[model samples]
Target: MILAADLADDRGWKGPNSATPEVVELSELLNRAKIYPLHDRPENFRSPSSVSRKIGNLIGSHPSAPRNALRTSAGEVPIVNRFVDDRTPMKRQAADIRVRIRRGLL
Candidate 1:
Protein backbone atom coordinates (compact mmCIF):
# COMPACT_ATOMS: atom_id res chain seq x y z
CA MET A 1 0.00 0.00 0.00
CA ILE A 2 2.83 2.37 0.92
CA LEU A 3 4.59 1.56 -2.30
CA ALA A 4 1.44 2.26 -4.30
CA ALA A 5 1.02 5.56 -2.46
CA ASP A 6 4.60 6.50 -3.22
CA LEU A 7 4.07 5.72 -6.89
CA ALA A 8 0.95 7.84 -6.97
CA ASP A 9 2.76 10.64 -5.20
CA ASP A 10 5.69 10.52 -7.58
CA ARG A 11 3.97 9.95 -10.91
CA GLY A 12 0.55 11.42 -10.32
CA TRP A 13 -2.56 9.29 -9.93
CA LYS A 14 -3.61 7.19 -12.87
CA GLY A 15 -7.18 5.99 -12.78
CA PRO A 16 -7.77 2.33 -11.92
CA ASN A 17 -8.38 1.33 -15.52
CA SER A 18 -5.05 2.55 -16.81
CA ALA A 19 -2.31 1.26 -14.57
CA THR A 20 1.19 2.59 -15.14
CA PRO A 21 4.23 0.37 -15.62
CA GLU A 22 5.25 1.09 -12.06
CA VAL A 23 1.89 -0.08 -10.81
CA VAL A 24 2.22 -3.26 -12.84
CA GLU A 25 5.69 -3.79 -11.39
CA LEU A 26 4.36 -3.24 -7.89
CA SER A 27 1.69 -5.82 -8.57
CA GLU A 28 4.36 -8.30 -9.63
CA LEU A 29 6.37 -7.60 -6.52
CA LEU A 30 3.32 -8.06 -4.33
CA ASN A 31 2.47 -11.38 -5.99
CA ARG A 32 6.07 -12.54 -5.72
CA ALA A 33 6.09 -11.66 -2.03
CA LYS A 34 2.80 -13.51 -1.51
CA ILE A 35 1.42 -10.79 0.74
CA TYR A 36 -2.26 -11.26 0.27
CA PRO A 37 -4.85 -10.27 2.86
CA LEU A 38 -6.35 -13.75 2.52
CA HIS A 39 -3.49 -16.12 3.05
CA ASP A 40 -5.51 -19.20 2.10
CA ARG A 41 -6.27 -17.92 -1.38
CA PRO A 42 -2.88 -17.87 -3.03
CA GLU A 43 -4.54 -17.88 -6.44
CA ASN A 44 -6.36 -14.67 -5.59
CA PHE A 45 -3.30 -12.48 -5.24
CA ARG A 46 -2.70 -8.88 -6.19
CA SER A 47 -3.14 -8.04 -9.86
CA PRO A 48 -2.20 -4.86 -11.72
CA SER A 49 -5.79 -3.74 -11.64
CA SER A 50 -6.03 -4.34 -7.89
CA VAL A 51 -2.80 -2.46 -7.27
CA SER A 52 -4.07 0.40 -9.41
CA ARG A 53 -7.27 0.53 -7.38
CA LYS A 54 -5.27 0.57 -4.17
CA ILE A 55 -3.23 3.46 -5.57
CA GLY A 56 -6.46 5.22 -6.40
CA ASN A 57 -7.64 4.69 -2.83
CA LEU A 58 -4.48 6.22 -1.47
CA ILE A 59 -4.76 9.18 -3.82
CA GLY A 60 -8.40 9.66 -2.93
CA SER A 61 -7.53 9.80 0.77
CA HIS A 62 -4.73 12.32 0.31
CA PRO A 63 -5.35 15.94 1.26
CA SER A 64 -4.45 17.14 -2.21
CA ALA A 65 -6.59 14.62 -3.97
CA PRO A 66 -8.50 15.79 -6.99
CA ARG A 67 -12.28 16.18 -6.94
CA ASN A 68 -12.81 12.97 -8.84
CA ALA A 69 -10.57 10.85 -6.63
CA LEU A 70 -12.00 7.43 -5.90
CA ARG A 71 -13.72 6.77 -2.60
CA THR A 72 -11.46 5.01 -0.14
CA SER A 73 -12.44 2.66 2.65
CA ALA A 74 -12.42 4.05 6.21
CA GLY A 75 -9.60 1.70 7.24
CA GLU A 76 -7.31 3.23 4.60
CA VAL A 77 -7.59 6.82 5.79
CA PRO A 78 -5.29 6.46 8.80
CA ILE A 79 -2.62 4.70 6.80
CA VAL A 80 -2.88 7.32 4.04
CA ASN A 81 -2.66 10.06 6.65
CA ARG A 82 0.49 8.53 8.07
CA PHE A 83 2.04 8.44 4.61
CA VAL A 84 1.03 12.04 4.05
CA ASP A 85 2.57 13.12 7.36
CA ASP A 86 5.91 11.39 6.87
CA ARG A 87 6.71 9.63 3.63
CA THR A 88 10.32 8.93 4.58
CA PRO A 89 9.42 6.16 6.98
CA MET A 90 6.96 4.72 4.52
CA LYS A 91 9.54 4.85 1.74
CA ARG A 92 12.07 3.15 3.99
CA GLN A 93 9.56 0.53 4.88
CA ALA A 94 8.79 0.01 1.18
CA ALA A 95 12.48 -0.46 0.51
CA ASP A 96 12.68 -2.95 3.33
CA ILE A 97 9.75 -4.85 1.93
CA ARG A 98 11.38 -4.97 -1.52
CA VAL A 99 14.60 -6.25 0.02
CA ARG A 100 12.77 -8.90 1.98
CA ILE A 101 10.90 -9.96 -1.13
CA ARG A 102 14.17 -10.25 -3.05
CA ARG A 103 15.70 -12.27 -0.21
CA GLY A 104 12.69 -14.58 -0.14
CA LEU A 105 11.91 -13.61 3.46
CA LEU A 106 8.56 -11.88 2.97
Candidate 2:
Protein backbone atom coordinates (compact mmCIF):
# COMPACT_ATOMS: atom_id res chain seq x y z
CA MET A 1 0.00 0.00 0.00
CA ILE A 2 1.15 3.53 -0.78
CA LEU A 3 0.40 6.33 1.64
CA ALA A 4 -0.42 9.86 0.48
CA ALA A 5 2.33 11.15 2.73
CA ASP A 6 4.83 8.91 1.03
CA LEU A 7 3.85 10.27 -2.36
CA ALA A 8 3.95 13.81 -0.99
CA ASP A 9 7.46 13.09 0.18
CA ASP A 10 8.31 11.74 -3.29
CA ARG A 11 9.07 8.41 -1.66
CA GLY A 12 6.74 6.55 -4.05
CA TRP A 13 5.26 3.08 -3.51
CA LYS A 14 5.12 -0.28 -5.28
CA GLY A 15 2.66 -3.11 -4.73
CA PRO A 16 3.94 -6.60 -4.10
CA ASN A 17 1.99 -8.00 -7.03
CA SER A 18 2.53 -4.99 -9.24
CA ALA A 19 3.72 -6.05 -12.66
CA THR A 20 5.41 -2.75 -13.38
CA PRO A 21 6.68 -0.01 -11.07
CA GLU A 22 6.05 2.68 -13.67
CA VAL A 23 2.37 1.86 -13.85
CA VAL A 24 2.03 2.17 -10.08
CA GLU A 25 3.96 5.44 -10.07
CA LEU A 26 1.82 6.79 -12.88
CA SER A 27 -1.35 5.87 -11.03
CA GLU A 28 -0.01 7.51 -7.88
CA LEU A 29 0.78 10.68 -9.81
CA LEU A 30 -2.67 10.73 -11.32
CA ASN A 31 -4.39 10.20 -7.98
CA ARG A 32 -2.21 12.84 -6.33
CA ALA A 33 -2.91 15.34 -9.07
CA LYS A 34 -6.62 14.92 -8.48
CA ILE A 35 -6.40 14.93 -4.69
CA TYR A 36 -3.89 17.74 -4.09
CA PRO A 37 -6.07 20.32 -5.76
CA LEU A 38 -9.02 19.61 -3.49
CA HIS A 39 -7.22 19.28 -0.18
CA ASP A 40 -3.96 21.14 -0.07
CA ARG A 41 -3.75 20.96 3.69
CA PRO A 42 -2.22 17.73 4.91
CA GLU A 43 -3.95 18.10 8.25
CA ASN A 44 -7.36 17.88 6.60
CA PHE A 45 -6.94 14.26 5.54
CA ARG A 46 -7.93 11.25 7.59
CA SER A 47 -5.41 8.75 8.90
CA PRO A 48 -4.82 5.66 6.77
CA SER A 49 -7.55 3.03 6.96
CA SER A 50 -9.66 5.25 9.21
CA VAL A 51 -12.53 5.71 6.75
CA SER A 52 -16.02 4.24 7.14
CA ARG A 53 -17.13 0.97 5.65
CA LYS A 54 -19.74 2.76 3.56
CA ILE A 55 -16.99 4.42 1.54
CA GLY A 56 -15.22 1.12 1.31
CA ASN A 57 -18.39 -0.41 0.08
CA LEU A 58 -18.57 2.20 -2.62
CA ILE A 59 -15.09 1.39 -3.84
CA GLY A 60 -15.79 -2.32 -3.68
CA SER A 61 -18.92 -1.89 -5.69
CA HIS A 62 -17.30 0.21 -8.36
CA PRO A 63 -14.53 -0.53 -10.89
CA SER A 64 -14.06 -3.49 -13.23
CA ALA A 65 -12.19 -6.30 -11.58
CA PRO A 66 -8.86 -7.76 -12.75
CA ARG A 67 -8.83 -9.72 -15.99
CA ASN A 68 -9.22 -13.50 -15.73
CA ALA A 69 -10.14 -13.04 -12.10
CA LEU A 70 -12.34 -15.63 -10.45
CA ARG A 71 -14.61 -12.75 -9.62
CA THR A 72 -14.99 -12.20 -13.37
CA SER A 73 -16.72 -15.53 -13.61
CA ALA A 74 -19.85 -13.52 -12.95
CA GLY A 75 -18.91 -11.43 -16.01
CA GLU A 76 -17.56 -8.51 -13.91
CA VAL A 77 -14.90 -7.83 -11.34
CA PRO A 78 -15.06 -5.76 -8.17
CA ILE A 79 -12.44 -3.08 -7.71
CA VAL A 80 -12.02 -3.23 -3.98
CA ASN A 81 -13.00 -5.30 -0.96
CA ARG A 82 -12.52 -4.73 2.76
CA PHE A 83 -12.56 -8.47 3.38
CA VAL A 84 -10.07 -9.51 0.68
CA ASP A 85 -6.59 -10.80 1.37
CA ASP A 86 -3.36 -9.38 -0.04
CA ARG A 87 -3.31 -12.09 -2.68
CA THR A 88 -6.65 -10.94 -3.97
CA PRO A 89 -6.15 -9.05 -7.18
CA MET A 90 -7.35 -5.44 -7.15
CA LYS A 91 -8.03 -5.57 -3.41
CA ARG A 92 -7.64 -2.10 -1.99
CA GLN A 93 -5.56 -1.74 1.12
CA ALA A 94 -6.48 0.70 3.88
CA ALA A 95 -2.92 1.58 4.82
CA ASP A 96 -2.07 2.60 1.27
CA ILE A 97 -4.12 5.72 1.32
CA ARG A 98 -5.41 8.57 3.49
CA VAL A 99 -7.82 10.65 1.49
CA ARG A 100 -9.37 13.80 2.92
CA ILE A 101 -12.96 12.59 2.81
CA ARG A 102 -12.75 8.82 3.02
CA ARG A 103 -10.91 5.90 4.54
CA GLY A 104 -11.49 2.17 5.02
CA LEU A 105 -10.05 -1.17 6.15
CA LEU A 106 -9.15 -4.18 3.91
Candidate 3:
Protein backbone atom coordinates (compact mmCIF):
# COMPACT_ATOMS: atom_id res chain seq x y z
CA MET A 1 0.00 0.00 0.00
CA ILE A 2 2.22 2.80 -1.28
CA LEU A 3 1.15 6.36 -0.57
CA ALA A 4 0.97 8.88 -3.38
CA ALA A 5 2.45 11.58 -1.14
CA ASP A 6 5.56 9.50 -0.45
CA LEU A 7 6.12 8.91 -4.13
CA ALA A 8 5.74 12.64 -4.74
CA ASP A 9 8.54 13.42 -2.25
CA ASP A 10 11.04 10.61 -2.87
CA ARG A 11 14.06 12.12 -4.65
CA GLY A 12 15.68 8.76 -5.48
CA TRP A 13 12.56 7.41 -7.16
CA LYS A 14 12.15 8.48 -10.77
CA GLY A 15 8.40 8.01 -10.86
CA PRO A 16 5.98 8.55 -13.71
CA ASN A 17 6.06 12.06 -15.18
CA SER A 18 3.59 14.64 -13.81
CA ALA A 19 3.65 16.80 -16.94
CA THR A 20 0.49 15.17 -18.20
CA PRO A 21 -2.87 16.86 -17.68
CA GLU A 22 -4.30 14.07 -15.47
CA VAL A 23 -1.31 14.22 -13.11
CA VAL A 24 -1.56 18.00 -12.93
CA GLU A 25 -5.21 17.76 -11.89
CA LEU A 26 -4.46 15.09 -9.27
CA SER A 27 -1.57 17.16 -7.88
CA GLU A 28 -3.83 20.15 -7.48
CA LEU A 29 -6.33 18.11 -5.47
CA LEU A 30 -3.66 16.52 -3.24
CA ASN A 31 -2.00 19.75 -2.25
CA ARG A 32 -1.52 20.03 1.52
CA ALA A 33 -3.47 16.81 2.12
CA LYS A 34 -2.01 14.88 5.07
CA ILE A 35 -2.73 11.16 5.15
CA TYR A 36 -2.04 9.50 8.47
CA PRO A 37 -1.53 5.75 8.51
CA LEU A 38 -4.37 3.65 10.02
CA HIS A 39 -2.41 3.00 13.23
CA ASP A 40 -1.91 6.72 13.80
CA ARG A 41 -5.51 7.68 13.05
CA PRO A 42 -8.58 7.66 15.31
CA GLU A 43 -10.02 4.44 16.69
CA ASN A 44 -12.60 4.24 13.88
CA PHE A 45 -10.20 4.76 11.04
CA ARG A 46 -11.93 1.84 9.20
CA SER A 47 -10.78 -1.59 8.05
CA PRO A 48 -8.78 -2.29 4.90
CA SER A 49 -11.75 -3.94 3.20
CA SER A 50 -13.88 -0.81 3.64
CA VAL A 51 -11.11 1.30 2.16
CA SER A 52 -10.69 -1.15 -0.72
CA ARG A 53 -14.43 -1.14 -1.44
CA LYS A 54 -14.53 2.65 -1.45
CA ILE A 55 -11.59 2.74 -3.86
CA GLY A 56 -13.25 0.10 -6.00
CA ASN A 57 -16.34 2.28 -6.20
CA LEU A 58 -14.26 5.25 -7.31
CA ILE A 59 -12.10 3.66 -10.06
CA GLY A 60 -12.94 0.00 -10.37
CA SER A 61 -14.66 -1.86 -13.17
CA HIS A 62 -17.27 -0.23 -15.34
CA PRO A 63 -20.67 -1.71 -16.14
CA SER A 64 -19.66 -2.09 -19.78
CA ALA A 65 -16.02 -2.99 -19.18
CA PRO A 66 -16.25 -6.28 -21.02
CA ARG A 67 -18.05 -4.78 -23.98
CA ASN A 68 -15.57 -1.93 -24.35
CA ALA A 69 -12.44 -4.00 -23.85
CA LEU A 70 -9.69 -4.30 -26.45
CA ARG A 71 -8.86 -7.86 -27.48
CA THR A 72 -5.24 -8.65 -28.34
CA SER A 73 -4.18 -10.80 -31.25
CA ALA A 74 -3.06 -14.36 -30.58
CA GLY A 75 0.68 -13.52 -30.72
CA GLU A 76 0.51 -10.17 -28.92
CA VAL A 77 2.54 -9.80 -25.71
CA PRO A 78 1.91 -6.69 -23.62
CA ILE A 79 5.07 -6.83 -21.49
CA VAL A 80 7.71 -4.16 -22.16
CA ASN A 81 11.43 -4.33 -21.21
CA ARG A 82 11.82 -0.95 -19.49
CA PHE A 83 12.33 -1.86 -15.79
CA VAL A 84 16.18 -1.57 -16.09
CA ASP A 85 18.58 0.18 -18.45
CA ASP A 86 19.48 -3.23 -19.87
CA ARG A 87 16.57 -5.17 -21.30
CA THR A 88 14.85 -7.62 -18.95
CA PRO A 89 13.87 -10.91 -20.55
CA MET A 90 10.23 -11.57 -21.46
CA LYS A 91 10.29 -14.80 -19.39
CA ARG A 92 11.29 -12.82 -16.29
CA GLN A 93 8.63 -10.24 -17.01
CA ALA A 94 5.99 -12.98 -17.33
CA ALA A 95 7.13 -14.51 -14.04
CA ASP A 96 7.02 -11.14 -12.30
CA ILE A 97 3.52 -10.56 -13.64
CA ARG A 98 2.39 -13.94 -12.33
CA VAL A 99 3.78 -13.14 -8.89
CA ARG A 100 2.02 -9.79 -8.81
CA ILE A 101 -1.27 -11.37 -9.85
CA ARG A 102 -0.89 -14.04 -7.19
CA ARG A 103 -0.34 -11.32 -4.60
CA GLY A 104 -3.50 -9.50 -5.79
CA LEU A 105 -1.59 -6.41 -6.91
CA LEU A 106 -2.41 -6.63 -10.62
Runs of candidate 2 exceeding 4 Å displacement: 1-39, 48-50, 53-56, 59-78, 81-87, 91-106
Better of 1 and 2 by TM-score: 1
What lDDT score is found at residue 29 in candidate 3?
31
Candidate 2 RMSD to the real structure: 13.8
**Global lDDT of each candidate:** 0.75, 0.30, 0.32
TM-score result, candidate 3: 0.21
In model 2, the Cα lDDT at residue 47 comes to: 27
Give the Å error, residue 71, model 1. Answer: 1.5
The number of the candidate with the highest lDDT is 1
Worst lDDT 10-window in candidate 1: 11-20
Q: lDDT per residue, candidate 1, 1-106, as tens digits?
A: 7777777767654454435687788878887774544566556467888888888888788877776778888877777787778878987887888899878788
Q: Which scores greater on lDDT, model 1 or model 3? A: 1
lDDT head-to-head 1 vs 2, winner: 1
Candidate 1 Cα errors over 4 Å, as ranges: 12-19, 36-39, 42-44, 66-68
Per-residue lDDT of model 2, residues 1-106, tens digit only: 2332122113222122222353354343334444555456354233223222222323233333233322222211222222232323222332234342233221
- Tell me the alpha-carbon RMSD of every candidate: 2.7, 13.8, 16.8
Worst 10 residues of 2 by lDDT: 8-17
CA displacement after TM-score superposition, residue 103 of candidate 1 (Å)? 1.0
lDDT of 2 at 28: 39
Query: Which candidate order results from sorting by lDDT in descending order?
Result: 1, 3, 2
**Worst-scoring 10-residue span by lDDT in model 3:** 75-84
